[model samples]
Target chain A: MSLDKEKIKHVAKLARISVDEAKVASLTKDLNSIFKFIEQLNELNTDKVEPLTSILNQSLRSRKDEISDGKIREKILQNSPKKNEEFFVVPKVVE
Target chain B: MSNITNLSLSEILKSIKSKKISSLELTQAYIKNIENAKKLNAFVTTTFDQALENAKKFDNKPNNEQLLSGVPLAVKDLFCTENVKTTAGSNILNNFIPSYESTVTKNLWNNGAFLLGKLNCDEFAMGSSNETSFFGNVINPVGDHLVPGGSSGGSSSALAADLTPATIGTDTGGSIRQPASFTGTVGFKPTYGLCSRWGIVAFASSLDQAGPMTKTVNDCSIMLEAMSGFDDKDSTSINKKKETYSKNLKDNIKGLKIGIPKEYRVDNMPKEIDELWEKGKKILKDLGAQLIDISLPHTKYALPTYYIVAPAEASSNLARYDGVRYGYRSQKGKDLIEMYENTRSEGFGDEVKRRILIGTYVLSSGYYDAYYLKAQKVRQLIKKDFDDSFTKVDAILTPSTPSSAFKIGEKTNDPVSMYLNDIFTVPVNLAGLPALSLPAGLDKKGYPLGLQLIGKALDEQKILNIGYAFEKNCGYKNEIKKWWS
Candidate 1:
């Protein structure tokens, strides 16, 4: 399994992860090996096998019988790096 | 040692009420253990001041029936504790601390359980080994430099080291159960949504569920009572009326129909695990549980299917970590896009990035039908296998992990080798079944072997009862620290 340096960067971009030019060489090797391992899984005869999604076989357990999230608003925003009275502040998303 | 660690939470609370051991004394003992057992690396962040303050509050409260009052407990780093750093084992969120507390944690704290610290885990709750954490991999205290299993590795490691009496952990896939298997403790993942996920960092949303890891089955049941409740904050939180889980600890194995799936007897299974499985079956048989051969034909697809679906969800869930609103922000670059890329690139570990890309690729428009859609359908089929098998049995039994804990750095180099560790356990998660891993016996290398019991939905009581019965007759009683040495 060969992962080109450029492909590593491309995958990183798609995945929203960062990789430096110097680290690209090693990541390529590691990523290729990972795919190779995944490749071994390809050998299994999963033709008729169904893919498992969740441990539970039931429909999603949901709650809508009521609505109340009491208190703790101040507790929730207290640790933010930047916070206004009731809002979280961030660098402007727009120009 | 005040013997509280050995005692179940029920017994610990009773001791505290009797004034035999003060909350302060118990808290100090656990803190001391954490300090001395540095190599175990269980705690990523310690909260001594918070623990003392909470202890005082417990002393003041009426406290009629809190199961874990003043009992020191570890919190997995993935769960957001108010004002605490919850990096989810990722460097990207190193500076990110939640202004909010996760519901499960707040529930535990409200029940007067003392907070020991935030336990280490795999990065973003990914990977099989604990090595993916930015804080450094947590070590299994039971072996010669063996690894604690991931995602919930830290909590399992802590309980094994007796650094904390109990810990809260998230099991997305087999994070809680497999690590518990490796560490020789009882790790339980309740029926999905029994514990609320609000303020817990999302990994694979559909699969993530927070549960307890403790030294014994009884402590697990006690902690679950406090940790579970309906939460509007988490859309998936089940609204079953809150009930004490400890009421189910009868430990009677009579008339229990146990299902043994033949598919788990795969080629990669270790010989010792086969012996251990036979031993566990014989014990249950001796206790009068009718063991029957069953089939879960979709078992072979669980690993591949889990990888596809979990990563698909992870790609979307992790998208919230851009450098904009919170967490780590890369320094100035040409534009905002560069900053986002740089920060994430610098922040995430190798395994996390791999999953993210893999998740994105599978979920992308061109490949969705082939990868993500196919995986979801297969997942339903896997659940169907369990449902079909459950009709013939009360619970399903299997080895929690194929082998006991391997040495630290043993399987980290090969991602697939690490993924295989979750093979037996992941299928249980995909089906959203309640499961528990308890110490069954020891491998030839003297490592602990864990036995898992998977039960149908909301059958947590059934599985816990079975596990408690297994733990009662297991040879590890009173020999935790000594047996490992």
Candidate 2:
């Protein structure tokens, strides 16, 4: 159940975080220790127990389709790291 | 009058109403205290100018209906303040200013409270110690080098140091209560969905809850009332009338059954903490409450389940933080993928990155059932244990932390040891219940130790009353020796 270096790197990639090669060994060690601690859950028999989706035990409440929140395009885009007049600027995807 | 900075919230409110003290003058005093306590690192941003301007407006015509008229309070950086930088203690959102306000903060403003500033916290409300903050570690006012228990560390420390009259903090698995415990202040985490989560940076949507951190239990009660209500924006927000908790805060605990969970008696718990728990049980007993031994066998699994669920939710929520949108972006990326990878790796701290990896690993293809699904089912068992215990007892009592505040870097290197700090407090969050930590006694080094009172869902009143009873009879004075001053 211990996480290997490859698995750790894969997880970092999946999370979109770039871990340096030097830190991979330590991260793998830490992840493996954590997994070892988490392995204690295997002791219990959860054959009939249902996974808890919500602690309140209620289904998601629906709201009517309406523009309750709008008119903040400029405000929302103000914090963008790289934005032009109307769109976010990014590296060329097509090229 | 005594120093204006040292006055309680009730006293400040009363003085402002009676025209004995101007709100502007009172706010200036608080601003001065915040300035003097700069070494504590309690604030991420100080809104002194805006606070003064609002104080002047409040002074022009004090609204009778406003419960917190002209009160200056600090908010944890987790809650967004419009036109103000809301960095949830992470460098990732260091520059992310919200155009809209968090519902809880909006409620506070509507009730006539002015923001002193946004306080520091654990990045994304993740850590138990404030050292994980990108702003650097918040020093505990109790001692020169101790950590103010976190996620809500800045909130608790600010209140303890009199830097702000009161502060608002969010609790996801003991973030609010633990900091309050470490800093000798009052912290309450209301029932999930009691306060709308809209605009607060989502860490773990299912577990994160907004509540009040204050100097006294009475302040905690009223502040929670002011900060909580139904919001159409937050899907999980319960549509219920806000209960006036301060009005119903009765100290009568006669005939009430208080449960002391036997499972909480873990191995190698400090003697002082064990003695404090016994003292707390004795206080309830003397107040005519029957003490019963109950069992929450699944308590041991709470931390592991929490680590699973929280990070799983965090990984999903934080997916929006790509370099293109907001926050920090790396300059050395070759393309979009490298930009995202580099931005996240550079923006997030080691603890945040670690959690995200664990979350991604668990929710990945083959490990989902073994890790994520099993954790969720275990979470159910933890909640059920509370339900079973509550059927026999009206409320539960336990030590707020395994130990009092520790040195800044004492447990930082070891993640597992740091996670153990929330052992006594996480089970409440798993059950979506209300809980509070109150100053009960001082440890050997004269640092404050807190006793936690936990109650069923929406039973904030019960825990508040029990806390009120204890505060009156426990005779624990949380007054520090003004080290920061």
Candidate 3:
């Protein structure tokens, strides 16, 4: 089943993307086409097939468990659209 | 100085060696081009002054044999560079300057590469057409009205327009190849994980790959060599030792096996590209390479599989842009939720928002097993298609795109048509294999067709060798369409 206009609005709510009322209709159509495409996946017999992560048919590499990332907080915060001294700034949340 | 604008790196090196032009003068010429072509939207931002200033820092400017020593290459806006705006062509990242450099960009700078500017790209590399870019679409140098293809449209357009020598672009699902085909240039997406993705903005993590768009296959190799290497910072990065791209330039293709997937000749595809593929096979066969009929039976499922897998990952990846952190925020909103909604809705282009919705719905709690996990299994089937074919052939050959470049806004209104353009190229990315799009021939419509070569994992050199040989026999020149001129 495809996402209805109501469910799409709910998903937009979840994703934090505001949908214009007019766009909702078109979004509903596009989302349905995609869902139909994805619906084809249901036809595949995957009862026994293992989900593959990398296409090379290999396992992921694991390194020594250690915390090694160094201090670069200042450089990182420089690109923040809005920042408050050491932290990223945003609209006030607390009362 | 031998048209400093479009000269290959080798040609530039020769001029620099002969002292015919100083590195600073060459940088200035490119700077001039960038200034003149800024209206093309080829570059998002140009640090020309900083680049020249860096050129002046070199001790023996002309005497250095730094592969790309003085060449100014444009980077797609996705790669993070310290203090530079890395927007991924979306308003959400409109002011999100990264704090550090991506390993690829850092490697280029370490090799004394002049960072001329960041090229434009589709918003989060999501759209197949450049139309979704927040900075306005990149104008195809060939036809201002026709698309240059996307999401790496700017890189291909930049290279074609001679505004920049070459540019680095990421390919998730034909982003690099389709644009390269459309622009009539070379676009190579090395095996996934060959180039470090550290500090690059995420789209679909598993499929996002950094590669080059340039005038020739050799330039693609030279640029790819500089861009690729292992980095621990990117967990998906391969630990394989770096291979020399230039070492086997003259490799012969006498006994090379080129597979043509049977399902790729689907009836819905444009007949013009199909005709061009026929000619491509004749040329390769005439050149002594054996063309074999191979079955990649799961090819029909590639597009749907990619849509499911890519959007599923895109939804998760784009979730980070919730306005509370580092990106666009709403001017006036009541609560944090409202701010996040307003910011993203206003910040992302329509295509992005559409994908996000699809991604969210598929990966939702109750729907995950039905959509995301099932799609993962389909993805394996798609990979198996290539895996089974590689057993019979050294590499796979097909049209990079079903047709040549379409006009801007042609398919933008219809999402499925836009997705159809990637039919020929998306499978390789889903399988994490190396592939390249080089100039094959032109369609009857006067647009270019690209012959694609898909190689086994980390077998980029093999694909490049095939491309090098194809160019040798076919003698396909970079025939810039008359519309742009």
Index of the highest-DockQ prediction: 2
Clashes of each: 16, 0, 2
> TM-score: which is higher, 1 or 2?
2
Give model 2's TM-score versus the native structure. Answer: 0.99
Docking class of 2: high
The parts of candidate 2 lying over 4 Å away from their true place are none
Clashing pairs in 3: A16-B341, B142-B484
lDDT of 1 by residue, B117-181 (tens): 98899999997779999999888877648888888988888888777778888998899988988
lDDT of 2 by residue, A1-95 (tens): 77789878888889999999999988888777777777888889998999988888567799788777777789879999999998999877777
Task: Please name the candidate that would achieve the greatest lDDT relative to the true structure.
Answer: 2
Show the lowest summed lDDT stretch of 10 residues, model 3 chain B.
B476-485
Q: Which of 1 and 3 is the better model by DockQ?
A: 3
What are the per-residue Cα lDDT tens digits for candidate 3 across B166-254?
Answer: 78899999999999999888999888889999998999999999988888888888888888898988888888888879666764788
- Per-candidate local distance difference test: 0.80, 0.90, 0.83
The total of clashing pairs for model 3 equals 2
